[model samples]
Target chain A: MMNPISRVAKSLVLLFMFFTLHATAQKITPYLQTTSQVLELPSRVLNETRTIYIHYPKADSTNPNKTYPVLYLMDGESHFEMLSQYTDYLSRWDVNVIPQMIIVGIVNTKRTRDLTPTESIINYFGQPDTSRVSWMKPSGGNERFLQFIREELKPYVDSHYKTQPYNILAGHSFGGLASVYCLLTHPEMFQAYIAVSPSFWWDREYILKLADQKLKKGGSLNKTLFFSDASEGVSDSSTFHTNLLKFDAMLKAKTVIGLRFEYNYYPKETHMTEPMPAFYDALRFIYKAPYK
Target chain B: MMNPISRVAKSLVLLFMFFTLHATAQKITPYLQTTSQVLELPSRVLNETRTIYIHYPKADSTNPNKTYPVLYLMDGESHFEMLSQYTDYLSRWDVNVIPQMIIVGIVNTKRTRDLTPTESIINYFGQPDTSRVSWMKPSGGNERFLQFIREELKPYVDSHYKTQPYNILAGHSFGGLASVYCLLTHPEMFQAYIAVSPSFWWDREYILKLADQKLKKGGSLNKTLFFSDASEGVSDSSTFHTNLLKFDAMLKAKTVIGLRFEYNYYPKETHMTEPMPAFYDALRFIYKAPYK
Candidate 1:
């Protein structure tokens, strides 16, 4: 014999509890996971310990046998997350094109020191800054930087992670210049190379000369290269665009066998903005055909 | 008085201990001082708990008086990381365009139900789909779905986080349809709308018809909109391209004041691959003039 009002109140409480618990239980859980590691490298050239940021897809316990290709990117502090996200999404279980690769972001200690070749006074404006404590001080150590990668870094990464031998070296601006340098000097280091708006004017275009010297006429240099430039450092005079045109022509003139290359010019995009589209296009171009 | 071998062994032991301590020290150091929380919403209509991934930029404790714009993204599960990474990188003190904003990724539960305006039997191939448990079975609930967003989701987000009323709603394909629907039905919900590769063929082009009905001729609909499409479900005979062309024409025909709009067509890109480039273009187009 319960009163009608009391019975209604009891029912209301029960209903409230049910809704609350239901809402609490309905929480949507995320399935995405990530793993990261920091490696400290003693750079004898710079006499400093450089920390590299390495981010890889979280190993799926269910499929332990899967191995991944590696992408070595310069300007790690700048574009690590971009590459990481792109790699993760493109290599998703559903949308698999590129393999789930390890991203080795070489964080800059002295950007100019590692990314530039030939210690010179040339700036983006093609004018020399003779000022002391200029940002360009202690420049042109890309050769040693490449050595660090070829000798020290690559071995360390291969040993620690499940990796495929196929590797890609990517860079932007001075990092772009470094990527090209690697391609010309140490062609065996990477299977593919991506240079987004390389400062080809670096050291009076030292790498361009190297390319001309290294690549013989109609020689076979089996590799994939993607180079792009945005509406950056492009003036009324022949500076940015001209340099890229020269590089493009050099590759074409060489008629280098097994050299699959593409040059993209984004007049609408700024230097900073070019990486977004360029990186996407680069990945697509690199993996355009199945690994032959 | 130690022998040479004993000295070498002692040095090796010291080196191992030093390395261990160094590794421990590195492990304790955090890269980003930011933390994020995941939000879950259950929809009785969709029969699923929709997971909305969120990334709120770490509040600068030094500057207590700060607020941010919100970028509401569709297809949350697919492109959340891309947007998150883009926002984080672009808004760094180095490359600031848009203010550091909170990212709200609206994951799909009933994608077809929430995105399509009408229930139609037409399939992608222009054939009637009569199969049981078809993906298009529970369709044409976008209006109610929008109500859920405007009433339930937005309120919850505003109440919990510090947000400015200026919001951007972004989507792709079916999500794109929902975005355009929101713009037409609830214009006050967001300041900007982005529709990438919208499935214009949905419900025999119901949205195009709705747009004609809702958008008053020569009216002022002060809002920004970006719409784009790739080669999706398009062959020699399909009307996907024609449908988009008609929609674009309708948009242009309306002399809506303060209506900023951009239409892009990527012949090289496919529907599945268009999101990467389309999203980038959308962001750049939306933020272009104001930034310049």
Candidate 2:
């Protein structure tokens, strides 16, 4: 039994409150489960400005002082988000297959220089490319790149983040060559290695020769490795498929007791599409056991 | 050539600028490719506040008026980011496998209530649970849930966002059951459906019987579907595996035309882990051709 004026005023007030609440509740915020940081790292080793993307595991309330294993990824600009998403999703409380690990994506400043093991004028077709501006020019700075990673990037990440001793180095294509090369040349740098279609064609199959040399060195190496190839191996028509096979066979002939490895071949998938599956499988293979 | 005091002053200035640049550049921000909005929509159909997470594709400068297919994903809290990341990665300028999609994630308030098609006391082992405080007490409100999506949610999305005519419904586990259920009952709602390990054992195989009835109706269904099962199928001690087989066979026996479908079986993976690969495969299968 309110009067008309009173009822009207009450309705207007109610409407105003509802709209205010509605507007506040409708605040559009980011729906991200985890956060990542981008650092513009100055590198004297490569003489260039390097971009680093780091995705740390979300702080666990159960263990505040928990330290995580570090996964150093190459081709950050291409696959950083994909790896970060996988790590976050797979290491979830309910979906706990892989342990929580910090992902440090090292973006390439110079692709050919940092990834290839040796310098050469040779192209993919077993012919020398004497072009004025070859894509493979200014190459063979991988040793210096690794020095930068080991001395500068590793130190920076270790001092800043909650990191465990276990380290994994992962990459695709030329970056894959860098990963496998690091395993042979500097095995102490990483506990595990993932090479998704390592380009062995560089410098007249330098990686295959390097692997052979490392095997001949006869040092008992304790490491885990996962390498893969895609349809491009055959379509390239330059012994790309056979090179991968030879690499696999060379690893299998390893008398080195502590080396555990798996090689996957994606016949249906192309070079680019292969990473999508290869990365997932590599993670599964590497993190079969949760790291403490 | 300069005095000691002047040199010291110059060094200090340089150091100060370096520190300022370092501090500003080190300002950690979110590394998200796209932002998502969480809208608390008041649904009159369900008489509750429905939480919706919508991930719209980044604005394309080339084609500002581009409308995207909306993927209505159940269990937004679990797999929304995965779908969003996959869509972003696959639709990149260089690695263009799939089209950019709008992911409308429908998180559940009452998972059991909203997902199941009918109310029943029958459990997974075909046994009745008469407990007073049962998990399935307030069950079988899926029709109401669909009503909410259709009457309230879909209209809200269509009006507010840049959505095309094509719609996709995707879910896993009980959510998977809902996706399939929606297809059989309301086939016109979405052009594509993805059900990862659907629970065919719900309420004494009601979904199986429903499929039979739908098949009997004999109307042509022009749609794309991708369904899969994992290790839990055989381990459940029920007809989960066989039911999935029956569903696949029934679909294959289709006198009705235009239903393009693929059924994948992952024997090595668990139910929880299956979604990782299943969703990726589903996306690849549905978008075999880039959507216009």
Best by DockQ: 2
Q: Listing candidates in order, what is each one's chain A TM-score?
A: 0.87, 0.90
Q: What docking grade does candidate 1 earn?
A: acceptable
Model 2: docking quality category: acceptable
Candidate 1: Cα lDDT at A247: 91
lDDT of each: 0.82, 0.88
lDDT of 2 by residue, A57-100 (tens): 88999999999989999999988888988888888889898988
The residue ranges of model 1 lying beyond 4 angstroms of the native Cα positions read A1-33, A43-46, A58-63, A235-238, B1-34, B41-49, B58-63, B235-237
lDDT of candidate 1?
0.82
Interface DockQ of each model: 0.34, 0.48
Q: Candidate 1, residues A179-210: lDDT per residue as tens digits?
A: 99898889999999999999898867777898
